[model samples]
Target: MKQLKILVIDDEKLIRWSLEKHLSAKGYQAIGAESGEEGIKIFEQNHPEIVLVDNKLPGIQGLEVIKKIKSLDEEAVIVFMTAYGSIETAVEAMKSGATEYINKPFAFEEVEVILDNIKNKLKIIKEIQVLKRQQKDIVTFDHIIGESVQFKQIVHLARKIARTKTTTILLLGESGTGKDMFAHAIHNDSTRHDKPFITINCSSLPETLLESELFGHEKGAFTDAKQMKKGLFELAEGGTVFLDEIGEINAATQIKLLGVLENRVVRRIGGTQSIPVDIRIIAATNRDLKRAIDDKSFREDLYYRLKVFQIILPPLRERRDDIPLIANHFITHYNSQFQKNVSHLNEGVRAMFLEYNWPGNIRELRNVIERAVILETMTSLQPDNLPNEMIGKIEQADNSSKENYTQGNIGTSGSIVEFNIPNEGFSLYEIEKQLIIHALKKSDNNQTRTSKMLGISRDTLRYKMKKYKL
Candidate 1:
């Protein structure tokens, strides 16, 4: 940080010089004035961050000087100087905008202590301003790069619901499907964009700690709770609270969260008062919460409440046409990040990305591009720049499709459909089960590859597999 200017104003020449000299030696750029009028002129010209003024002055009183300076800049940190006899006047000076008052005979050490405290506060304020700017500029609808119809529709729908006063938004998607991005974009696009957008992953903490974090505990509420604390919901008032991995919360926490959703109020663990909170709740998870509800792990009522504005982000493989476009976007991003001149993916690299099923979705693609950008010596991304496992997976898929096609299996795309119907009519369940088994066998029992062969999510395949007792 640059040197902070401190203005010292006193009627006595010695007091002004002594304070300025002491503060100047301490690294501040301290200046002085003989009278309140001179101090006002210097203050308006230089805009010093801190001001020290005396109670009795030649033309104007110190309290009057404080008011005038405050009129010019309300954020000015002013400390009043007075004698033992003028303590009453010091109190009056405080009422008129003085930050603190010290006796005239006070030690220079006292002044240094006050200045150190003010400096700490100024540093904190500056850091907060920087963080706010970064948050405001980082995530938005415009930054979401997708040209596919499904992706565009999801974005448009999210934008529409963001403008509303919807209390709860449930983002359903697989891991790495950009649920976190959607949560941030939705909050940044909402009416409370300027407020804090606090987020937490419920699964990251133990059940007890997660409960305490959500509904803050009072002092002495628990052994380690030394003081009263405000929870994220209270801190995020007038904005949004993103609860990632919401399905991971336990039954007790689920009941409490349901209360908050119903009443828009939260009570600390050991407190009696219900603090009202004005915020939207954005819950996201990669789990099949509907299945969890059936298994009694998730509360049905809470699911319905959170699903008021549900948005399911499709997997990356479902939007194959956007792979090249998304890859180019990541290539440009990593190019700027790593200071590289990587232009675009070569045709081989492009086909490898399209041929492979991105089980990790956009996040996986981003990592692939970032690695390629960092390692590639040529201008354009090449096949060797890709991960070896990706190429291996593609080779395996090609061989499996060919083998299944040669076996006269209709599961492979563009293959002829030739299945004999039982004379007594076939059972659809048996046919569907056999097809999944055949696909799994050809794909070497890999869930990701098997899901791609069946044109479904890995989670869906697991559910069907469980249903068919396979």
Candidate 2:
């Protein structure tokens, strides 16, 4: 665990000594300063987590010190220590971003209680920050639902590359194939997981503003630039910077980005000094960069720079075998989110899901499941609960299949099969058993291929085969 560092700033020698003694006994590294100026200098040198400022100081009042410390680090937690009859001053300190106030002439026990309270607050704050980072990073691929060979291979490659420190990664896929999720997973799995993971979409901003946003600017760099500001690259030092839609960046910005990749340094928009940065860049794009290079829309050198390690995420249509698993994952997720008890997708809905091409990929499927979960009252998601577009596509495919079967075209192309149920009502278990046997025979008893043909997992097929005494 990291030790807590505290800075106690007071004009009174006894108060400073008492705080230093008590804080040190409590296992904190406490430093004492006799005035506000001296305190600011110490804070700059030490960068302590907590600062205790005396409300009345010899020079440069405590409120000014609080303001200065906050200006240096906005998240700096400061507490104002005030004498008796200075409640108004303490309130003013609170308004100036002081976290809490400690009244003077207070007992040592009260000081101990206040220090413990602050320590607890700081701990909770640090935990929350870590939680937020994990939520953003781990949730992406931690519970990724897939068992298809192609999907598994992609995940394996991603995991293999995530252990490296400096390899630039490029995710190539369609818009909704979860490139951002892969980026987050790679960052979270890397050595810089504790550091920041910053994301910026290239196409979301205009060219000039986008440049400034990435490289930052010095004071008076632009009409709106009033003070020096750190850019995303500077802020994400020792971590990952995920640039989504990297192909959309303009030519000039592309040149600058290429420089950053080659030199590992960034220059502010109007500043001359080149600040070195240590960051892992992970870029994603749906556009064809090779074609963009041909058309002179993207830089070829930069494209090669970004593709040092590339992962192409397969579209959902190609991984239909994983739909059921992914859908069930969403059902479980939305059950807690929307407070619904939807346990599964009905048979008809499941069939429709397998038939649909899923042109928008996983994102569209997640949205569909979320909608169904929100509006569904039954225990299972039904076909009618699906979107109109999906239902129409499924119905159209069903009609086409029926027409083909009527024309005796079933199995002619070896792509379509027709099964008929008698009016007396056949057993679903019997039908499923026969289908499984047929699939097994078609695959030459290859369970993996059979599972793919049935759009189920190999484990599920194995369990069913055992249950059916096959």
Candidate 3:
């Protein structure tokens, strides 16, 4: 660990010498300055972690020095050293930004205890900074996996908009279509990527609490608000604030949000001061805001404010061509997570995946693949390894389609024949052979036409012919 550097600003020579001697002996690097001006100069030169300022300095007062130091470094930790008669001055110094105050003629043991407490607070602050950096690293654009045409188009647009620092982005999509992931990607790719990226689900909290969470509150603002707190907007200053399920926020909150978007300033609950914030707002929702506006549930002006640059994420069913790629990506991910060696999905599994309509979008597909990867005991994922509900849904769809075809209701021209199975359970192989024979006879033994009619590849048709001895 690095040694903590301290600056002591005192007019008295004995106080400065004694503090420097005791602190240096305790493994702290202490620098002494006579008067507040000299102390401010030393603070700028060395940038000490802690400052001990005497309230009754000769030239510049301790409160003025505290204000100057705070202006230089807002996070600078300061402690005021005051005489017994100057307790009110010390309090004024604290109001000016000094972290703590110590009385005159105090024991060295009390100073030691104060220094120890300051060290602990400094450690916690450092840890929080490290965690914020880690969070920024984790939410980068590289984590979003997709190569489909629609997905790539959305990603390209996101990357393009991410270069702008002040643009408001709206992500419109279904519940599980990865809107949150897109929000993260936009933030991590933006100019403010290194700063805090705060997220809050607008629907998750009550109206009063949501307002407090978004706009923050002063100490004693409410019954439970025992201390002052910074809201998501303040915490995400110089970065991004992601508001998920934004449609769920009430009308009053929506009006406040519009003011932030317009003025870039937020007022804390029960606080008169309006704090300016530099942040990009990314709001996402599954609900239709236009319909909500028509229903008078959501404000039209707020909706337009949020939709400055909107990206609508397509559902998974609309992008079926990307399923195999996404499924394999999830398979590889889960293989490492579960320590399994499952390689790929079987042909039947792939066919079933293609036939099913994924109502829950990419999230549902990921969950299904994760479950299959965990349960698979073989080298590949099979149809039997899929969830029973999924298999049943596919079977029901097939049955419905077959029934529609038999009733001559499947096609616009109504030219297809009704195919019925016997009650005794006919052989599937025999049925396939008869269908191929009839196709060949109808096509006058022309392999191309026979293959076309049978809806099979020419190679598959030839293989079946040889196997059936036809």
Candidate 4:
């Protein structure tokens, strides 16, 4: 066992001697001082882990001593021993940084219990600090926060793939499902963060200029070509180029991209020379690439090439277990940005957030929190600050499903349920089943329309269908 060091300070010789004897007998190295001034000097020299100071002391008061000790070592634990009928003084002692405010004439057993509690707390804090330090080594997982088993499995998979030089990684998910964030994580975690990470929105850009923008245009290549320009591929040499909305690329553009992917070279439009390039490719699509391939809207060969390392990000609704963590993360970020001291979410707000299907996925949730933080005061964010559309839904849910409703949408019957168990409670399966059934009933069972209304991955809905024996 580790040796415990304690400093006992009091003007009364009997009290100081008694404490020293009892603590020493309890296997502690005890130091006694007659006054607060002497106690401070003894503490400075001894560097004791714990201090027991009398509230009434000669020269300096116990609270002042605690403040001084705090200024010197913020982690130092000080227990203020005050006489009876000084409850107010004890509270003041606590506010001044004393670890515990105990009445004088207390029994040794009570003091011993308090010391044990403090020791346990300190042990937990030390473990937590060590864990935090270990986390500093992690670069990508910091942004992806979740205690859910599924999310953890995803992180585990991502970390393994990130260490490799995989060229094609197709991130499939719904819009606002954090595909872009995961793309950034993959790029940063990979061996190519030092190089440029160029992103192209195939759906956003015009097809006419997409080729030139991707492969560059030479001087006098076209009407607006005043000077030579490097395309995203050339600029991303020895790095990664993220093609978002890859499903939106036309067949012609797809053929061109296929050539670049296959040959690792690009020819500037209106230029004869083929420029050799070295770059990794990461593409994302909210659209079903397989469906596009089946429809002949996308090339099957290119689809195979992009699927070398496919990662499907679950929509926010699919991973409802992650909502609390994600919500807290956004709340922290918004609180800091908006300069609000708001530290916690009300139970009602949390309940509503978890219950609602985030159609926009993570993006939608982040936007809602950001908006609420900006618009609402430091006081509890009432349901009003939420999206106006959601308010109606929440109201309806509240009315019909008296258990589930917090004044939102058309509440379906039997929507409200509580879960509690010894250590283990409700399974994610049960909650998700209930939510889906409610959403379907609410949306009249239109799968496509229901998916949009629920803000969940269609794949997730299908998977649940099979899981629930639908």
RMSD, every candidate, angstroms:
15.0, 12.3, 15.8, 18.3
| Number of clashes found in candidate 4 | 17
lDDT of 4 by residue, 1-470 (tens): 38889999889998878888999898999999998899989889989989999988878898999999999899999999999998999999999999897887889998999999988988898899988995564346578787667878887887778778746889999999778878888878889877778899998889968888898989999999999998889999988899999999988889989988888899887888889988889999999888898899999999998888889888887787678678779888898888987666665676677667788898888898888878877556666678898777767754555433333232243334433433554454565577778778887887766666655545446556666876
Error of 3 at 269 (Å): 1.4
Q: Write the per-residue lDDT of candidate 1 for residues 221-299, one digit (tens) a residue.
A: 9899899988888988898999999999999999999999999999998899999999999999999999999999999
Q: Each prediction's Cα lDDT score?
A: 0.88, 0.88, 0.87, 0.82
Worst 10 residues of 1 by lDDT: 408-417
Error of 1 at 271 (Å): 1.6
lDDT of 4: 0.82
Winner of 1 and 3 under TM-score: 1
Give every collision pair in model 1.
Answer: none
Q: Per-residue lDDT tens digits of candidate 2, residues 95-191? A: 9999888888877788678777888987898899998986764744566668888899899889889999989999999978989889988988899
Considering summed lDDT, which 10 consecutive residues are worst modelled in model 3? 410-419
Model 2 TM-score? 0.65
TM-score of each: 0.65, 0.65, 0.63, 0.56
| lDDT for residue 458 in candidate 1, whole number 0-100 | 59
- lDDT for each residue of candidate 3 in 1-470, tens digit (9 for 90 to 100): 59999999999999999999999999999999998899999999999999998888898988899999999999999988888887678779889998888999898898999989999999998999999998766766687777766788888888999998899999999978889988988887888888988899998999999999999999999899899998999998899999999999998899899999999999999899989999999999999889999999999989888999999999887776677888888999899999998989876687677668888998999999999999999888988778899888888987786665445463454554445656665554675677788878898999989876755445456667876899
Off by over 4 Å in 4: 1-139, 396-470
Provide the global lDDT of candidate 2 against the true structure: 0.88
